[model samples]
Target: MFCFLIDIITYMHSNTFHIIIGPTIVKSIYSGELTYDSDQFFRTGNTNSYYYQAIDIIVNITGNYTVKSNSTIDTFGYLYIYSFNKTKLSINQVTKNDDKSGSLQFTLISALQSGVRYIVIVTTYSPDVRGPFSITVSGPATVGFHVNTAATKPSSSVTTTTRTTTTTTRTTTTTTRTTTTTTRTTTTTSKASTTSTTST
Candidate 1:
């Protein structure tokens, strides 16, 4: 008068998934020196005399990153999106910092995308200054640095443009100073009531 049911199931499938989160490298340190042989560039808003070194930044994950420098020299940092053109100092600039980490060091923060090429430019705040330095990058993944070996300088056209601008600026300043001096002399002469004052 009682009934019993039994069922057996068989399955054939298997899969494995590995997901990695967070930074693979907590901090990556790279040391280098900006010597006389290092590439140089005229930093934006600066004269053409600062020695600089360019490093290619490669990452495996997309996230925010912080780049800091440790050096005895007054350090300046620049972040570029794709490529850096020494002829055009600001063409691909994302951000730049100076002394943000204190003690003449710099700290730069920006969001970086995986598979995208980025360039970090390390230069000095003072012209022709050179010394050894170490840069540390902290981000979502280990950052790879490849030193760019290409020597860079402003293009001929850019050089011509810079010379023209400098000449124009100097001429303008000279004219302005001369005019001011003339005006001041006229005013003094008009105020002078005695012949001796006017003669002097």
Candidate 2:
């Protein structure tokens, strides 16, 4: 009997928005600063210039994954999974949330293809609402599969079973899972308020 095992690791970053190319799971709490003239901007309306900071990660497995951003002040979190083309990049999945009076959290539950680069952005609800914050990415670390060697002959004696175990670590941040099916695509967005928006 021969056994084959495959290990996958996802690298994620925070704060300075630096890219670390390697193989490992990332779960870190960062204390950073944000301002009106920070970095990238995700414009939804014609009000203020919404500034944002982004982190790029390469995913090698397909499964349900969650990303959380917690802050002392009101904030917003945005996630974008896309691919690059000859001229520009095309977005595959986009999720944004401004709920939970003090933080924002969103989950991407879709079939993520292997060898694809995904970008995750964490920002405030509006411009100039900046302070210390922490961001985390958690989900299944490995995806398992089994193959039977005696496929040519039909026999009831041969049995193959595969099991997958997923473990999640809990923190102060609240998590919400959003499911996305293959047949339909949905996008959820909420309008930012000047004050705090109570969660219902």
Candidate 3:
């Protein structure tokens, strides 16, 4: 005699799973009009300023970014990426570290909406030589569960007596001298991390 069986599972969870896996956003340096220099910063104004790329997001996101200096100027910078539709909403704004030779990298610890476009960049003030900046964001990762049936053995053959035993041991106390305990836990997990960019 032969037996065949199948197991199907359905799960419900937050669509935002990027918090797992790696950061949804992998950081990278801007290619042009940006570098780690302390002298050429003021070319635009006394407080060296410049905007890098625009990030288009489907939802309102909250993450941190950093602006750093690579020279020994011991200087700091600020990040203010405002939204086009909401002038008062600063998509990203914060101060980075004190490393004279490291670029700024900030993190945003908040939630995002359904549809919003954002700007991500940095502007700093120091002696006058600058070029190079990078931004990174955290998001959810995607994962899936599957059932495999690829084998040479007959698929309908029962390997042993199969049992889905959910054993919850509970302790029972006897009239005057004994105790018992029970354990209960159920887990079904999923994924995160996805990124896309557009001009804003």
* Highest TM-score model number: 1
Candidate 1 lDDT at 17 equals 30
Model 2 lDDT tens row, 1-200: 11333333333312222222333343323334455445534345554465455555445465555556666766676555653121221345456667743335333333445666566555666665666555555433432212112121111111122333333332232345577867777999999878777898
Q: What is the lDDT of candidate 1?
A: 0.73
Give one digit per residue, the lDDT tens place, for model 3 in 1-200: 11223333334321221112223442322222233321222323344343222223223334342222232323343323334212222335432233434443333333333333333333334334344433333333111111121211111111112223232323333234346888999897877778988998
**TM-score of each model, in listed order:** 0.62, 0.45, 0.30
Which pairs of residues collide in model 1? Answer: none
Q: Model 1, which residues run further than 4 Å from truth? A: 1-25, 44-46, 151-200
Count of clashes in candidate 3:
49
Candidate 3 worst ten-residue window by lDDT: 151-160
C-alpha lDDT values of all predictions: 0.73, 0.46, 0.31
TM-score for model 3?
0.30
lDDT of 1 by residue, 1-200 (tens): 11223333334422333232322435666778888777777785557788888888887788888999999999999999889998887798999999999999999999999999999999998898988888888865577887884653321110001111111111111112223333333333355465544553
